[model samples]
Target: MSLGKKLKQLRKEYKYSQAVVARDIEVSQQAYSFYENDKKKPTMPVIARLARLYQIPMSELLNAEENTKEQQMEKFIEVLTRRIWAIIDLKYLNNNFFDLCLVIEEQARISLMSVQSREILEKKEFDLDYTTLGKLRGDYLEPFKEEIENKNQDTELIPNLVETIFLKEKEIASKYFE
Candidate 1:
């Protein structure tokens, strides 16, 4: 997929509005919308913050498929049905990502659209949805658990999946660690 498409998919997977992503990356919602629609590419700093905010590696955020060898790296990629089953099972049983979001929400970066940004989008007549963001938090996470756990039909190693989800979640909650 193109980087823009990949970015859009990631934002949806995480259930964020353009304003939310922009705020997290410290950019205007218009700029973020441009990035998603491929009107422009984001700068390296913006890309880094985006990768960090979305809990994904820079390569995966950029969809660096050309780096196939790097993508196939053993540590970053693993079979879905293998030893990492432990991690899968943990995610399946415990959907704590939203709670993690709640706990660190103030300190951590966020991407929800403010009223002003919503007005701007409306004025611009863009079709992006900024509503229901607060509601989508825990609700959107459950349906994904089983699908993610079972996504191993081809058995290829998926690269940096954890960077976008698992490890990033852990990193967000690190202050609670003992």
Candidate 2:
């Protein structure tokens, strides 16, 4: 297409008036309108200025493709990423324990879905010795520790509480090895 069509397309994409583009390019609105309507040709300098103002490569504007496969691929990726984040946001909104429990769980769940635990631990070289991982484990798996500690119970209940805590700790530990 002609320079006028390219300039008009760029102007419309940005919701810019012909007058604004003309003012910025140091041309009269009548001249810019003539250019857009293909009745007049813009000087080389005016074309350069228009290209700069539109923040698009002159080549892309002159040879604009409405839906190239590469552009379609990029748009698809952008939309898919937005949708994935929306789903994650919804999960956090629905779950009250979103703070630390959520993000870690989501990551772990994704990993498990894509690979076996052995592959994750061995092939991916996931670090099992991290201190923060330990803290996260304690936070998620041992939810009743504070309650057990703060309980106003008789001396008779101490052994039962201790046994429950021990069993839960053992269960959590076994998960790591598996």
Q: Which model scores highest in lDDT?
A: 2
- Per-residue lDDT of 125 in model 1: 38
lDDT of each: 0.49, 0.50
- Candidate 1 lDDT trough over 10 residues, lowest sum: 107-116
Q: Encode model 1's per-residue lDDT on 1-178: one tens digit a residue.
A: 3566657756864679988989999999999999887899989999999999978789776663243433322212232113234443454324444543343232122221210123434554323222223233334344443444453422124344434443443332232221
The clash number for model 2 is 0
Deviation of model 1 at 63, angstroms: 3.4
Model 2: lowest-lDDT 10 consecutive positions:
109-118
Query: What is the RMSD of candidate 1?
Result: 15.4
TM-score of model 2 relative to the true fold? 0.37
- Cα displacement (Å) at residue 142, model 1: 24
Cα lDDT of model 2 overall? 0.50
